[model samples]
Target: MRLPFPSLSTLPPTLAKPPRYFPTLISHTSTTTTPYYRPLSRSLSHPSQPHHPQANHSTTPPPPSSKMSSPAPAQYVTVTPTPSGYALLTIHRNPVNSMNTLLWSQLQAALDRCEQDPNIRGLILTSGLSRPVFTAGNDLTEIFAPMTSREQYARFWTVSNQFLARLYRSPLITAAAIHGACPAGGTAMSMACDHRSISLHPASSMGLNEVAIGIPVPAKWAQLMATLTGQGEANRLCGFGKMVDAAEAKRIGLVDSLVDGEGKEVVADAVRWMEKTLRLPDVGRVITKAHFRDRLSREWEDEEWLRSEAEGAWEMLASDEVVTVLGGVMQRMSGKAKI
Candidate 1:
C-alpha cells in the first residue's frame, strides 16, 4: 500500500509552522544545543545548493570553537502523530539526509518529544524524500578535516553515538523503514531500533560501509550490527563494508521485514509491523528490549571511554591521508569532480 508523503498544508500546525530551530531537547535527560533548520527539498542534490555527504563520523568540532556561528533553524526532520497510536519521525535532511550534527540533534529532539509523550506508543523512523535514499549517512563536513575542528568532531562523535544509544534503549517501540541506500551511520540508526523493515526496491541497499571510505566502524555500532545479524555475518559484512541489497539483508537477518515497495509503502509496512508490537503489553516489551540492549547505552554513558573514542576519531580525521580521500569523495558526490 502506498502512503502519500504529508504535505505541510495537511500537517498539524506544529509541523506546518515548526518553531525556528527545533527546540533543544534532552536525550536520556541530557540536553543538547544543535541549531539548524533547512526547508525540505526533494532532489538527491543539485549543484546550485549545498552538497550532502554519505560520509562517516559526525560534528565539525573536535575542538569546538567558542565563536561558532549558529546556523539558521533548519527543518531537517519532522514528526507527525498518527491516529494509529504511533508517530512518524522522519529524517528529511534533503540531498540524501546526511547525518550531520544539526540533523542528529533535530532527530534527537523529535525522538525525545515522542518518548516523553504518553499518547505515543511507538516511533517509526524513515526518510522523507521522493527518491529511495533512506539516508546517505554521515554528512561529509563532519568528517572532513579542513572543514571541521577537533572540538567539532568531538561533539559530532558524542551526539551521533549518544542518539544511537538512546534509540537502542528507548522504551517506546522504535522501528526503521529503509526504502533506499543505508550505510554506516544509517545502519547504526536502524540497527539500534527494535525492528527494521526495508523496501525491496531495486535501488535499496543497507550495511556498514565504513571501511570503503577509509574508516573503521565504531566498535559499538559493530556490536549492535552483530547483535542483529550475528557476530560472524557482521564481521564479514562490516569488515568488507558491504552495502547489501534487500535479499541479502533479509537473508542475513540484518533487517526484519522486507516490504515489496518504495518510499511510503516501505514505511507503511513498518508501521503495520510496529502496531502489532504495540498491541502487546507495553511494559513487557519495553523491559524485554532493555534486557538485551541496555548494556550498550550504559557503555555510551562512560565519559572516559567515549572521550577516548572521540579522540581517536579526531586523530583520524586530522590525518592528511583520510582528509584527501574524504575530499575526493566529497568532490565526486557534489558533482564537482567526476569519478
Candidate 2:
C-alpha cells in the first residue's frame, strides 16, 4: 500500500541545511530573538557546552575551512517567548528535521541552556516549518554510514538517552507540538516531553516501528511508551510495529489535543490553552511530570541499559534484510531529504 504522504525526497520546510561542523554549544539569549549556534570557547566551564570533555583536550582553534573564505551564515533555532515564562522551541532543521547525531547533540545543549536560564520557565517543542512531517525520524544515512562503528552507535545511544532524560526530568514543563509523521525516535522524543499537543493532519502517522527494522526499542523509550498508553497497548503497538493515523492516535490517548489545521494558529491556540488552563507558578506542572517520568529514569539510570540495547540493535542493523529495507525507504525519499 502506498503511504498517504509523499516520499522523503520531497523536502519539507522544517529541515535546516547541514552545518559545516557540529556546534559546540547552542544558547537562546534572552536578549536575542532566536537561539544562536556557536563553537565552544575554551573559557567555557559548563557541562552544557557541546564540547565533550572527552573529545576536546587541546586548546587549539579549529583550522579555517578552505571551502569557505567567507563565514557561513548563522543558523538559529526559532524561539518565541510565552507568557508562562516558557518559550516555544521550534526545530528549523529544514526539509524534515530528521534527527542526526550532531543535531541531537545540539538539541541537548539547547535544552541544557534552557534549563539553566532563569528567565525561561518551560519549553514547547515544535517544528518551525510547515510539514508533511514534524520529523521523518532518525537520519538513517548517518545511522547506517560505514563510518558509524559499533562504538559510535553506543555513543549515539548514550548521548540520545541523556538528552532525552534531561528533557523528561526538566524542572520546567515541556510539551510537543506534533503535526506529521512522527516515527521511530521521533515518537520517543514526543513522549519525553511532559505533555503533547498534536495537529489533526489527516496525513499524520505516529508510532514506533523499530521491530520492522529488526531492532528492539530502547528500554527507556519502551517504558515511556508503556507509561503513556499502559503496558498492554505499548506491547501491541511496539511489538507489531503498528503505525496509527492522527485520529486513531487521539482515540487511543496517544495524543493529548488534536487541532483542526496545520498552521501557526493551531499552535497559538494550544499555547493560549496552556497559559490559561495550566495553573501558573508551574510548580504543579513540574511535579506532575516528575511523577510520570521518575519511573522511566529509575529503570535506566546512567543509561547503561539503553546503551546495551542499542548496541544489540545496531548489530541487527548490519543484516542485509534490515539494511535493504531501511535503505530503500530512505533512497526513495533522498531527493526530499533535508539539505
Candidate 3:
C-alpha cells in the first residue's frame, strides 16, 4: 500500500539526503558483478579530524569534506559581544554538536547575559566551526539516559523549555544561522528566534521529528511552528516529521532566507540580517516582539502549567513507546537496520 506521506526510503532524491555527512564511495564494475568500494573526500587525508562510526556505510554517499576539530573546553558556546551592539552565541559541541543539559544551561546563561546587557541589542545563534551538524537536536544518548527519578527527567525538560521560552520572548532580536542537519530540538530553537537563515546546501534542513519517534511535540513547540509557518504547514510538518531542504524551507517560511555557504559564511549571513533588523528602532522592535509573543509568554509564566508540561515530557521519555522507537533509531544509526 502507498503511504500518504513519504517515508525516508520513498522520499524523492531531493528529500533523501542523509542527516549526517558521509564520505563518498567510488566503485568499479567487475566480471563478478560485485562492486568494490573506496572512500574519497578532502577529510580523508586530514589526520586531525576523526570520522564518526556511521559514515560511508550507507548506499553510496557524498565526497569527504574538511576535518572538523572539537573546540577546547572554554569554547563550547562562545558568547562574543560586539562593540557595534549585538552578541553572538556559537554552538561548539563536537562530534555532531548535540544539546545536553550542560549545553542548555550554558545557552540559558548566555541568553540571560545578552538580555541584561543594555549594549547588546540582538543575539545570533550558530555553530562555531565548519562541522556537518548545526546542533543535531538533543543529544539522543543524553535524552535516553537512565532516569533514576521522574523529577530528574522533569528538571531536564524544564531547563530546556525555559531556555527556549526565554529565546522566544527575549526583548532583543534573535536569528539562527542553521547550516546543517537541524532537527528536533534544534528546529524548535531556530523557530523560537525572530529570524532564521539556513544554508543553501542539500544537507541543510530543519524540522520537528519528535512525533515520528513516538514522543509528542510539546505544545509550546507546536505553537512556535504554527506562529512562524502558519497552522496548516505546521501541522503537516510536525505530524509527519517531514524534513525539508533549505530552498523548500524558505518557500514555506520555516526559515527566513538561505545562505550560500556553510560554517562562517552562514553565520555571516545571519549576522548581516540581525544587523539589518537592529537598524530599526529598538523600542518598536522590543514592544512588537512582546506583543506577538504574548500568548507564549503567558503560557511559560504559568507556574503550574510549566511544571505539568515538564512532567509530561518526563512521562513520555519513560514510556515504552518511546523506548521501542528509540531502539529502532539506534539500530538504523548503527547500520543494523535499513532506513
Candidate 4:
C-alpha cells in the first residue's frame, strides 16, 4: 500500500525539534563548518538465491567460487537471501573490512546479484561480525601505493566512484547497519543507502573524514553529505575531517537512529526496520526514493564534473603532503610509530 509523504505533523516529537548544530570537533585549515537537521527519508527478501532462509544452508562451508562478479574475488563478500525476500550482504575482511580494489569489485558484484534477483525486495548492508571497528575506511596501503602515473590513481578513484554510483542508484531498498567506527569511505557507503542506523557506544563514531586523511570528497559524495546535513555542515565534517559519536551523529541527522545493542543485535534491528519499510508497495517506495535521490545521481552524468573529480582525486593521492599524512597514519596503525 502506498503512503502519503510524511509531514511535520506526522513526525515524532523527538524529530520535530529544531536541528541543533554542534561546534567543529576537528580542525583543518582548508576545511569549512552548520546546524540543520532534516528528516532523513529512508527500506527487504528473496528466494532461489544461495543461502536463502529456506535453504538448508550447508553445515559444511562452501568452496570458494566466484558467484557474483565476472572475475573479481568474491571471498570478501557474502550474499544471503532472507525469508522476507531481501538480500543481506555481509562485508567480511579479516582485521578490518578495509576497501580495496578487490573488495569494491566483490561488493559491486554482490549488489549486482541481489538487484538482478526479482525475489529480492530489499538489501541489508552490514559488516560480517560484531567488531569494534566496522571498517577503517579504504586500505590506505593500497590507496597510497607507489603510483607511476595519474592513470593509476585515476583507476582507483574510478572504481570507487563507480561502486558508489551503484549504491546510490540501486532500485532495491538498501539499509546500512553500522556498529563501530565508520569513517571516510565507510561513511560514504552508509550515506548512499536509503537509511542508516548506528549502534550506541562511545567508540562508535561515523563521518566523512576524507579530507583529514588528505582525500577530497567527490562532488556526488559531497552532495550526499549536503543532502543529510546542510552544505556548510558537510564541508565542516568532510573538510575538517572529524569523527562524531553515535549521539552526535543521530543529533546531526547523519544516522536515522542509535541502536541500543551491539553486533548482531544492531544488524537485527536494522533488518527489522527494513522489513517494515518493505511492507509498502515496491512501486511507490522505489519511485518516491528515486524522485528524491535521482537529482544527485544525475550529477554523475556530467562529463566535465567527472573529469574534474578524477583529476582532483588523483592530485590528492599524488600530493607529497597527502602521501606523508597517509603514511603516518598507516605507521601508527601498524605500531611502527608511537604517539
Question: In the order shown, what is each candidate's alpha-carbon RMSD?
Answer: 12.6, 12.3, 20.0, 13.9
Candidate 4, RMSD to the unseen true structure: 13.9
How large an RMSD does model 1 have?
12.6
Candidate 2 per-residue lDDT over residues 31-98, each given as its tens digit? 22233354322121224434323356766645666853455333424556655667777776667787
Residue lDDT tens for model 4, 132-221? 667667777556745335766556566666677767866678999898888878888898888888899666898877776566766677
What lDDT does candidate 3 reach at residue 115? 56
| Residue 41 shift from truth in candidate 2, angstroms | 15
In candidate 3, list every pair of residues with a backbone clash.
Answer: 24-62, 41-64
| Model 4 residue 128 CA deviation in Å | 1.0
lDDT per residue (tens digit) for residues 1-339 in model 1: 333445556432222333321233333444333432333222212113343433555534345456544555677777888777788887786677888887888777677666555567788988888778888888878878898898898888888888788788877788999998887788889988888999888888888888887778889989888888899999998899888999999999988999887788888898789888877876555555555666677796566777899998888878999888878787878732211
C-alpha lDDT values of all predictions: 0.75, 0.65, 0.69, 0.68
Name the best candidate (by TM-score).
Answer: 1
For candidate 4, what is the TM-score?
Answer: 0.74
What's the CA error at residue 93 for candidate 3, in Å?
Answer: 1.0
In candidate 3, stretches whose alpha carbon ends up further than 4 angstroms from where it belongs are 1-75, 145-148, 335-339
- lDDT, residue 297, model 3: 58
Query: Model 4 misses residue 117 by how many Å?
Result: 0.5
lDDT at residue 43 of model 4 (Cα atoms): 13
Worst 10 residues of 4 by lDDT: 38-47
